[model samples]
Target: TGVSKGAMLSHKNVVSNVLQASGAYSPTLDDGAEFVVTALPLYHIFALTVNCLLFLHKGSKNLLITNPRDIPAFVGELRKYPFTVLTG
Candidate 1:
């Protein structure tokens, strides 16, 4: 894959992407058992797709952090979850 600015995506594209991406990772994924620490704000595309939708489709437990600036709170949140996957 090459790098470029993000493209605009439709809801269907997103759903398809999540399904395909998760399928690519299925061999390593433990359906409904992964705990994900999603530090990124869901407003962003990468987080919205890979962090939120992808994991959600996998039935993962997500810890959404609206603010990642507060170091103390972020660390505290991290401590609370036995996260197997993280976005940062």
Candidate 2:
């Protein structure tokens, strides 16, 4: 996976990607009303920008999964919440 060196992104770059993704996905989220299940580690750009930042920007709840490898526990946790969006 060591394919390239780390690249820096400005605040505008991050926000712009989030906005573009939101438009493309058209997530039907309500402020503080929807739940988002995020199985990927937040350290990753995809999870950091989309699942955590973008959803929070729209005021949706974020359910962080510390260990997605535990399938049973993951499924159990998923069932516990009426998640509106799921990203891994």
Candidate 3:
């Protein structure tokens, strides 16, 4: 069976993770200019830390994909933003 893993993560931990990741990429990434495509749900830890908080902290706008399964619509949306970063 296939099912999403759901759990609660502490704010401190999530923030720490985001900060750590941001630090490493900050040197090469430009602020307020990056467009990030987040295909994974924000509730997921990976998306929450890297796609949302980390990128947002770096002043990047994230295109949250509510329904990633719709490839046609997702691809169409991509044309609207000049995405420099993508994560799923």
TM-score to native of every candidate shown: 0.84, 0.83, 0.84
For 1-88, candidate 1 gives per-residue lDDT tens digits of: 7876777788899999898889899999899999998888797888988889999899999998877899899999988879999877
Model with the higher lDDT, candidate 2 or 3: 3
Question: Clash pairs of candidate 2?
Answer: none
Off by over 4 Å in 1: 1-7
Q: Between which residue pairs do clashes occur in model 3?
A: none
Residue-level error in angstroms, candidate 1, position 30: 0.4
- Ordered from best to worst TM-score, the candidate numbers read 1, 3, 2
Please identify which of the two predictions, 1 or 3, would achieve the higher lDDT against the true structure: 1
Q: lDDT for every model?
A: 0.88, 0.86, 0.87
Per-residue C-alpha lDDT of model 2 across residues 65-84, encoded as one tens digit per residue: 99999999999999898888
